[model samples]
Target: MTGKRATQLALLGVVILLVAGLVTGAIGAAITGRDPLLPTPGIHLAPQLITGEARGETTKEVFSTDFVLTNTILSSLITSVLLVGLFWLGTSRLKVVPGRLQSMLELIVEGLLGFMESVIGAARSRSLLPLIATIFLFVLFNAWLGLIPIYQSFGITRWTDLSLTELSKAHVTDVKGKPTITVEDLKHVVEAREAAAISASGKSEAAVEKEAHKFAETNRIEITDAGTIGKQLVVDGNPVTVEGQRYAGKAAEKIQEAGGKVKTAQAGLSAAFLRPAGTDFNMPLALAIISFFFIEILGLRALGLGYLSKFNFIGSLLRFKLIDAFVRFLELVSELVRLLSFTFRLFGNMAAGEILVLLSAFLVPFVITDIVYGLELFVGLIQAVVFAGLTIVFAAVAVAGHEEEGHTAAPEHKQPEHGGGHS
Candidate 1:
């Protein structure tokens, strides 16, 4: 096919797919009684095949398995393995006339080395290439991997419990010996109940919250004695009962059936099996720590114990130069701040992008999601380059500290000599 014709055909196919997806999603929503635009992306701290117990119960101890494999860790490991395999295969045999893989590797290495050389010079760039390149490739792979739809879809089922106190404050009735939840408290109660149910059923918390809001807006909550409350209370014009003190809901029922204390369950729910690796704060923090450590090591190797002087304001303090000391103190603060900067920048960008993609997919399904996927690809590449580039710049600054100090001292030495010569 001609290139222009091929492009037109691709666009046609995408339009058809989007139309089909929209129709299918709308039909599914109608059948399921759920909103087609509501996203069910699970957000979790850790990935686990099974959840242990609901939090907030002082009476019982909840313990999960010794180790649960999380998606972040899984993604990191996979990225590392792929990087190793690619480099190994590319460099395995010496090539007089390089093959495609070898040429690609050479191009990437040469490009990075040339860039680093411009900042830190050719000698130091070669030494720093392994660390810089590994970080770039690993982060790049992770960013791209997250764009894959499978990461958002598949995961294990887990349950969370809710406490009554968490839902709302209780008014203790002296005669019936039952706590009555007020109308104001009912919204919170229902939301907690709904969230638990939805999460346990492997739906997203976003969807749960949306449903809870809709239910709360439509319904009014009332509590009275079992005799006066009737068979059910009217909620959003529908009758819902309290079987005892608990709300008549699937979440409450599940808790009761699971032999869990339902005096109001705690908020625990099922989530996606894995969160994107870059979204986890620890991943970026770990990378920052590693980068900083290596930067320090490179500084130490280049300038020995003299590198400590870059941070120490002791000389300024002893000399009674308050301004110098203040500047030095600021420098110290900036050094520490770099860790936070590195950690948050990567985490925030990646996490926000992942969330954006999820929201877009939920709102528009096939069409808009594809556009977001492309944006994420660009964002991922930019982030990887930024991270690696910053590390190189920092390394350059760290190692050049002595040289900077010498340059500063030279002018001082020259000034005295020029004054002496004039005298």
Candidate 2:
């Protein structure tokens, strides 16, 4: 590597690290004595997960937004743009002895092409290289995209959450048999939640009481309406609103007035991204449609009438008319099964992989999460390769099938003419 090239590589690596840190908010976190969080259940180290009072599920939005720009997107885009800029500069310079970065990129492309050739042969690989590369890029981008922690770190729009458990419900009930809006009622409700949690978990009464007291001591809450907008109330010069007569603090009121940032939560259904690899119906169904079309096209192009041999279009097997028809139909089902199998296989694998990484991160801190993370990255890449590679192999078989058995068909037809001539 020339001095310039070496410098460029070092710079590029630093840029990546910097951008990754920004996206994950790791640099700032390290400075602030915080940790990177994996999106998971049971615990949320950062406010990103959006939680409410304890005691089970939180359906309330931690944050909500309508297509608001997030830090994650910004960081990922910056990283990608910088990487591209560097590549362009290096490639355009066109060094007879390429810079280290250029040389490295070349190696990656060559290695990938070589791998594809091994899987589908040089001729077919050449034809399918573009698709394979597209798949590779998609996988790479999607895997890296989530590393940006901007949106995770801070969000603008949040949801109104209310804890309405049976126990809390009781604590708030007034002397007149109505849930009153009072500090005493709120305190009692908080305590009730603790009791309920321990009881539901089948814990000792003493433990539940201790925990209930602990939670009450720690939480400073001012309950508001369950609606999207909080109703305003002036309680002692401080703005307050009651949800079920529970107060909303002046702090929440002030932020709401000044237009505090809105948080954009995930708006899409999880299923779309989480669909397993080939295990889901989509991948294989796609494969089946794509594979079968080419198969038929090749079958027709090469075998012509002989392609019907797949259905006993020739020979004495047709003598058992019923059996022949049944066999042909059965073979047709194989095409459909291939598609079904491909979809679920990929969906199951990818979904499982993504979920595992999430859960593992929740189990431990990020520092020791390298092994599980590496495994996830590996699985995602392999799945991408397999899906694309199989597509190529199917295409090849479809194109080549007719050519291989093409001669057999003409001979069979000739035998029929010869018999007719004898008769």
Candidate 3:
């Protein structure tokens, strides 16, 4: 076949798939009284547990986990390894005629270094290149690598259940001397009812008790294989059989109650084994803190003790210049405020991007999601640049000497002259 013919055939296939996806996706499923081709993906703000025992069943239990290993951590590790491996490959062998890998690496570094020199001097930019470049690469790769299909396609299934024995122990008598369960206690009440149902259905006392004990325990969560994730779902420990594309949630529950093993939810619900580190608040906050530390360090190096004077309200207050003292205080607050601004800016954008992609896939499937993915690639690059570029800019401002408006401009700091530089 000719290349042009092959291209035309590929396009035709794509168009057909797009049409079929729309017909079977969320909208079409709703109209047809059938399960959607894709289940509604759940949104989670906090990073999901990969290997840890939470205090409770929900994400709120995250705070109390014993040595939690979250999906975001896995993602960061993978990103780090990828970066290290690529750099190693590029520099491990020297070539007068550069290979593609080396050339690509050089292009990125040289472009980033030139940009930095425009903000700070060439010497200073070169000196800080390691920190700034690493930051940019880490953020960029973490965002981009997450776009891979495997990141959230497979992970620990989300499981929740009621515990009757725990509920009974949690009850208390109210002022009216009547037994009443709080709304919070309702989750546990279902276990007792389920146990009785099993007993009525010809299960022996011991068997019923054992089944009851299982319900009284916290929901069992296990990792689903990537190969079977979207196709076969296990709820409460039982593999759910789909009739056509639909699985009934109530029917699954009934099966569990009647002593047939099943898991929670209609379609198997799962948390990803790896999520974009940028989507987690901690990842961005950590980067911001590291950036803040380096900025202050650079300021101190360039200005010595004079740098501390920016926040030195005591001298102004002792001189009874309350206004100047207030301004100094504001400056200090602004410095701290940068941490929050940096954290939320990256976190919000990445999280929102992730949600948009998932929703696009769920609602329209094949065609629209590809477009959204392309947009995300651009967004990821922009966010990485903004984050690293801001770090360099802030460092520059920090090191630049300050002069009072009415006073003679202070002589430029000699520190930057040493190696930091305007040349």
Model 3: colliding residue pairs: 235-262, 235-263, 235-264, 236-263, 236-264
Count of backbone collisions within predicted model 3: 5
The C-alpha RMSD in Å for every predicted model, in order, reads 11.3, 14.4, 9.6
Write model 2 residue lDDT over 12-51, tens digit each, in one string: 9766755554545534445667544322232111112222
Clash number for candidate 1: 10
Local accuracy by lDDT, each model: 0.64, 0.47, 0.71
Stretches of candidate 3 off by over 4 Å are: 1-18, 31-34, 55-66, 158-238, 243-271, 402-423
* Candidate 1 per-residue C-alpha lDDT over 66-160 given as tens digits, one digit per residue, 9 for 90 to 100: 35445577677777787899999999995989999999999999988898899999888888898998888888988987787776555432222
Residues 189-244, candidate 3: write the lDDT tens digits. Answer: 33554465566568899998898778556343222322112222232554433431
- In model 1, the runs with Cα more than 4 Å from the true position are 1-34, 37-39, 44-64, 158-273, 405-423
The model with the greater TM-score, 2 or 3, is: 3
> Which 10-residue span in candidate 1 carries the lowest summed lDDT?
224-233
Best lDDT goes to which candidate? 3
TM-score of 3: 0.71
Better of 1 and 2 by TM-score: 1
Q: How much does candidate 2 score in TM-score? A: 0.46
Q: What is the lDDT of residue 102 in candidate 1?
A: 97
